[model samples]
Target: MTSHKRKTGRRRAVIGGLSALGITGAAVVTATLLAPAGAASAVAAWPQAKGSKPVPASIEFSGTYDGKLQRHYGTGALGSDGQDESQKPLFVLKDGAVLKNVVIGAPAADGVHCLGSCTLQNVWWENVGEDAATFKGTSASSVYAVHGGGAKSASDKVFQFNGAGKLVVNKFQVSDFGKLVRSCGNCKKQYPRTIVINDVDITAPGTSIVGVNANYGDTASLRNVRVHGDPKKKIKPCVRFTGNNTGKEPKEIGTGPDGTTCRYSAGDLSYD
Candidate 1:
């Protein structure tokens, strides 16, 4: 556990898109882009959260989003960490809730938190403060075609998966963050923490890829994932796996532009 804490703290400081289609809603909340010329436009059509109630349907967001940052949702259980009205996340998808076509602005910590079976599609996060997004608790969830510009600091990561069941992240694009993806799992639970990262593109000149990590007997698989480092910077390997690492060893498939391949053993992986 000492190693775990030390690695977690060290990893803490270190680590760590979009798409298209339909618009269905009567109340079109038009919003302008704070972006420069040629920047795409976005709008928020969904209604804001009224108290502690989840919206009946999925939320499709574009442009900028401020969750009010009035409350902090607990780590586990929808309200497990403790239900306080401190500040709520932008959107808390109830079981089966989906958050798509969303782009988070900078100076924000509360992005999207998933409780149970949920899907996050076509989501883009830019300059996130802390965790751009998270998949909390032991549930089956998937993040599809997500993109992240970077994080506010070098200590924050782009995404975290703390669930015990199956978690799939497909078509993810990110750059300039410490750890690209992290997982802190439970040791006592027997359920496996299976994480599959497919079609991922990461460009962290001096950062660590730190893909899927399960300390307590978990497994991670990386396929068609590419990690690029700045030619002039000193960077670590593309993937790092720590902890007891007693589960199935990590598997990485894919190569870098310069013929850099992934080297995987029990605890570390260098994917070029």
Candidate 2:
């Protein structure tokens, strides 16, 4: 069969079954907001979405371990917050994976976060939901791990030395209150180390969802995309570019959508 045929086929992969070296739900997870299902943070007992791309059929992983492992979960959650919706994300990275209609019902921190390394050629996130994909990470020593509360897709930045991976977001969409994707963490100035986004829609009016964040002064690109709100109710700007709201304007990235586009390209966008 051809590559396209395989991609359009079913998904089958090997997930988690054993624990990490010293990482635990109570130890690693200090406190956080939310995250959609199938989040990388929940890799231990990573729950497969009812309608996500199957592992063996379409997925792979690269971390401290070798192959995928399936773990047992309770309430399907992450972070220190007990308000995580049950929207587990089915993370995978294989040669060919086909994702059909799927609905992740819950708040999430991130859908996928590849560390060791991964490369996916034919894949999809068609109809992916972000009930409440939050993008706020707390500091733990100096490593700056990932946060909870909010859905997360493949980051927009990556490196072979740090995290070299290929993720394609095709026919994706969010439904709840959260962000589409972001490159953040407990790092200096919160940089987008490894991640990316492609072809997506955020026609959700329940809450706003951010697409990508080019932290660390990196240039995150958003090619063919569109975001809008309900006709009856007035919503804020589709994009919120924040900065050191010093009442100053962003002198970078197209002058920024006023101060809203937190460009921070120039300096502090504080509100002093």
CA shift of 128, model 2, Å: 10
The most accurate candidate by lDDT is 1
Tens-place lDDT digits, model 2, residues 94-213 = 222222223223222223323222222112222223222222222211121222111223222111111222222322333333344433322233433323222334443433223223
lDDT of each: 0.43, 0.27
Clashes in predicted model 2:
70
Cα lDDT tens digits for candidate 1, 59-133:
334433334422222222232111232434556665556555544443334556676655665555555445666
TM-score of each: 0.51, 0.35
Root-mean-square deviation of candidate 2? 15.7
Q: After best superposition, candidate 1 residue 45: deviation in angstroms?
A: 24
lDDT of candidate 1? 0.43
